[model samples]
Target chain A: MVEQHIASAFDRDLEAIQAQIMKMGGLVEAAIMDAARALETRDEELAQQVRQGDKAIDGLEELINEEAARVIAIRAPAAVDLRLVLSVMKISGNLERIGDYAKNIAKRTAVLAQGPNVSESAAAMRRMAREVELMLKDALDSYIQRDVELAQDVIARDRDVDQMYNALFREFLTFMMEDPRNITPCMHLHFIAKNVERMGDHVTSIAEQVVYLVTGDKPEDDRQKADTTSSVPQEV
Target chain B: MVEQHIASAFDRDLEAIQAQIMKMGGLVEAAIMDAARALETRDEELAQQVRQGDKAIDGLEELINEEAARVIAIRAPAAVDLRLVLSVMKISGNLERIGDYAKNIAKRTAVLAQGPNVSESAAAMRRMAREVELMLKDALDSYIQRDVELAQDVIARDRDVDQMYNALFREFLTFMMEDPRNITPCMHLHFIAKNVERMGDHVTSIAEQVVYLVTGDKPEDDRQKADTTSSVPQEV
Candidate 1:
């Protein structure tokens, strides 16, 4: 009877932690979209809000971790239950990192708001961030539903984000080569794009965690990176 | 008698995991130094070695995590022992990330080796990398010794790394403004500097984990960031 009671309590604890994960995921997705929108509209106020909102996301991660540790200490969960707790810790860490990238993008957006607009780059970055936000939404859904196929789909979509970042990178280089005045703004835009690309990578990591949670095995590390700016010869 | 045997087994498991952590730390330290030397000396072969060597570091992290999970499951360590296991998982994650940064520096080094030299930037980056390497060594030492003072010292030194990054950012901007030819090379060098700066951040995180492991509380998040490039006015 006591064993059954402890198991029920563990189930309740797991459910509560999962709920927190979803809430944190929701905040990160909003941060991504709002930061991108701020850059697109040059809305410094929106950018400031995104920056401030990250504190809540960070706090949620800490709360989730503490809760996970308490459950582990008190319940002594075994096998699959233990794996679930560990995966929750990792997913929250990924979410916190994604929030940080959003904060970085907002910081750069504030700086770029003072400079001249780099043509169409902000719009391009918004599209990229939009894709990442969708991936994160699906990634979270997969975790809640324990749907491996949906998580795999999210992993596959990160390549598109990388490709978008590479395009922005080359475009920024061309702009800088054309005009010295464009250099500073384009550099800032380039980093914002890079930050968004990293967001996709972290989203992919969350999806991978979902796969591990379901299968009890890590997915193969065969995801080919599509960001080639680091490798291409400096012909520009 | 049986309980004592299990306790000794758990101790053995913990010792093996810590040994792996030390080995991983050594590899990461070598990677940082090798990647920096490759950039400073324009040695493509050395850079390639650092890139390939990261696989070993990554493999060790995976191994450490598996062992940690096993220990947690079989031993079901509670309280302080459980915290030690959890901290090992997080520290390995940080070390894996630092290795990735070193690989990134090497990738950029291979590209920059083909281009005309940006004056003194590579050497300056080497100096920055050296500081992070030293900080990491101290961080790992503190982890093994459970020395909170040394960990705190490592945390404090990250500020120097950030200040170095800011100086490099401004210098890169000046070079780009002076000659368009310096734009591409300076951008690559700038990223290498930023990567090293991020390495410092990760080392600080490892040190923070050390503090947490020894003391049952998280250190205050009051560490001020000295990297002002993202926020500074775009006058350059």
Candidate 2:
């Protein structure tokens, strides 16, 4: 009877932590979209909100971690239950990192708002951020549903985000080459683009965690990265 | 007698994991220095070595994490011991990230080696990387010794790394603005500098974990960041 009682308590604790994960995921997704939108619209107010909102996301991660530690300590969960706890900790860590990237995007957006408009890059960035946000939503859904296929799909989509970032990187370079005045703004935009790309990577990591949680095995680390800007030959 | 045996086994497991952490730390330190040296000397072969060597560092992290999970499951350490296990996981994560940054620096160095040399930036980057390497060494030492003072010192030194990054960012902007030919290389160099700056941040995180591991509380999150490139006003 006592074993059953403890098991139920663990279940309840796991559910609570999962709920917090979803809430944190929701906040991170909003941060991604709002930061991109702020850049697109040049709205410092919206950007500021995104920046401030990250604190809540960060706090949620801390809460989730503390709760996870408490559960592990008190319950002494074994095998699959233990794996679930570890995965939750990792997922929250990934979420926190994604939130940080969003904050970074907002910070850069505030700076870029003061500079001359770089044409079309902000909109491109919004589209990229949108894709990542959708991926994150699906990644969280996969976690909740324990759907391996959905998690795999999210992992596959990160390549597209990388490709988008590479395109922006090259475009920014061309703009800078064409106009010296464009250099500063383009550099900032490039970082914002890079930040969004990293968001996609972190979301991919969350999806990978889902896969690990379901299968008790990590997926092969053979996902082909599409970000080639670092290796691209200078055309200038 | 059986309980004592299990306790000794747990101690052995913990010791084995700590050994791995130290080994991982050593590889990461070498990676940082090798990547920086490659950049400073334009040594493509040395950079390639650093890139390939990261696999070992990554493999060790995976091993450490597996061992940690095993220890947690079999030993079910309580309180302080549990915190030690958790801190090991976090420290390995930080070390893994720092290794990735070193690989990134190497990747960029390989590309920059093929281009017309940008003057002085590579050497400056080497200096910045050297600082991070030293900080990481001290951070790990602090962890092993449970020396909170050394960890705190490592935390305080991260601001210096950030200030160095800010200086490099402005210098890169100046280089890019002065000549279109310098734009591509400077951008690559800028990213290498940013990667090193981020390495400092990860080292600080490792140090912070040391603090938490020793004190059972996180240090206040009030450490001021000195990297202002993202928010700096456009001077061009």
Candidate 3:
């Protein structure tokens, strides 16, 4: 009876921290959508909301860290339990970075609001952001379900985001070469695109952690990346 | 007597893992300096060595991780012990990333080898890389000694690296504008300098982890970063 009671209490602590992480993920997911929508529609108010809202995400990270630390201190969990706590902390850190990237996209979107709308390319970026947002959702779901396949699926989607980013990189270069006026705005847009690409990487990492948790092995070496920036398409 | 023996065994485990982290740090430091020297001297052979040497650094990370997992599993460490294990894992991850950045710098230097010499900026970049190498050294020392102030000092040095990068950014822009022929090489140099700047960031992150491990508190809000790429300095 004593052993069973101690086990239950320890589990309750893990459940509570996991709940915190899910809550944090919800906020990050919302930020991703909001940032992308603001970019797509040039919504300054929405962009402002994302920038202001990141503080709450940052605050949740501190809380999750504290809870995880406290659980480690008091529970003195064995290998499996320690892995759970450590991974939750790591996933939360990744979510926080993803949120920062969302905020960065919003900042650039605001800069882009005043200038000409690179509407065609902006829409392409929006699609890229959507793909990453879905990946994050799947990554969090896999964590909750302990579903390795779902996590692997999320990891694989990252390549699509990378390909989209490379396409956008080529397009941006052409835009700048076509018009000197496009240089400043296109640079801003390119940086924003790069941030979105980086967010995909963090989500992929989160998924990789999920795989590591479910199975003792890391994800098979990620597919050879195709996002080499220097390999610009031929200018006929 | 039994309790004392267990405690000493735990200390041995901790010491063993710390030794591994220190060994990894040594390799990363050498990689950083070698990458910079290759860039300065335009030595493709030395660049190749940095690239090849990174595989050993990656191998060390896997070993450190496996050891950490084994300790957590078998020893069932208490909260303080768990913190030490987790922080060591985080430091190893940082060092791995620093190695990757060094390899990236080396790759770019190899590309620049075929182009006209941008010797002036390459020299400046070497100095910038030196600052980051020193910062990484201090960060690792602080980790080993558990010195929060030294860790904080390492964090502060990142701004200097960022400033150097911004100055180089301006210079690269000027070079490209002055001569269309200079565009390709300057772009390569710019990317290399950006890689060095990012290495400083990873070092800062490692120092932040050290501060957290020692004080149980992350460094209070890092000084506001001033590396806004658009803030091109106006000549007086």
lDDT string, candidate 3, A24-68, tens digits: 999999999999899889899999999899989999998998788
Candidate 1 lDDT score at position B119: 86
Q: Where does model 2 exceed 4 Å of error? A: B1-8
| Interface RMSD (Å), every candidate | 1.5, 1.4, 5.2
Error (Å) of candidate 1 at residue A100 is: 0.5
lDDT of 2 by residue, A1-236 (tens): 98999899999999999999999999999999999999999999999999899889989999999898888888888889999999999999999999899989898888888877878989899999999999999999999999999999999999999999999999999999998889999889889899999999999999999899888788776567899988987555
Clashing pairs in 1: none
Misplaced by over 4 Å in model 3 are: A114-119, A230-236, B75-80, B179-187, B230-236
CAPRI class of candidate 3: acceptable
- Give each model's clash number: 0, 0, 0
- Note the DockQ of each predicted structure: 0.69, 0.71, 0.29
Which regions of candidate 1 deviate over 4 angstroms?
Answer: B1-8
Q: Tens digit of lDDT per residue, candidate 1, span A1-236?
A: 98999999999999999999999999999999999999999999999999899899999999999899888888888889999999999999999999999999899889989987779988889999999999999999999999999999999999999999999988988888898888888778888899999999999999999899998778775468899989867678
The lDDT of model 1 is: 0.92
Tens-digit per-residue lDDT, B1-236, candidate 2: 99899889988998899999999999999999999999999899999999899889989999998899888888888888888899999999999999999999899888888888878988888999999999999999999999999999999999999999999999999998899999999989999999999999999999999889888887776578889888888655
Residue range B1-236, candidate 3, lDDT tens digits = 98888888989998999999999999999999999999899899999999899989999998998798777666767777878887888889889999988988887777777666854998999999999999999999999999989999998788899999988887876665565455556656777888899899889988999888888886665356756673332220
Candidate number that wins on DockQ, 1 or 2: 2
lDDT of each: 0.92, 0.92, 0.83
Considering chain A alone, report the TM-score of candidate 2 relative to the true chain A. 0.97
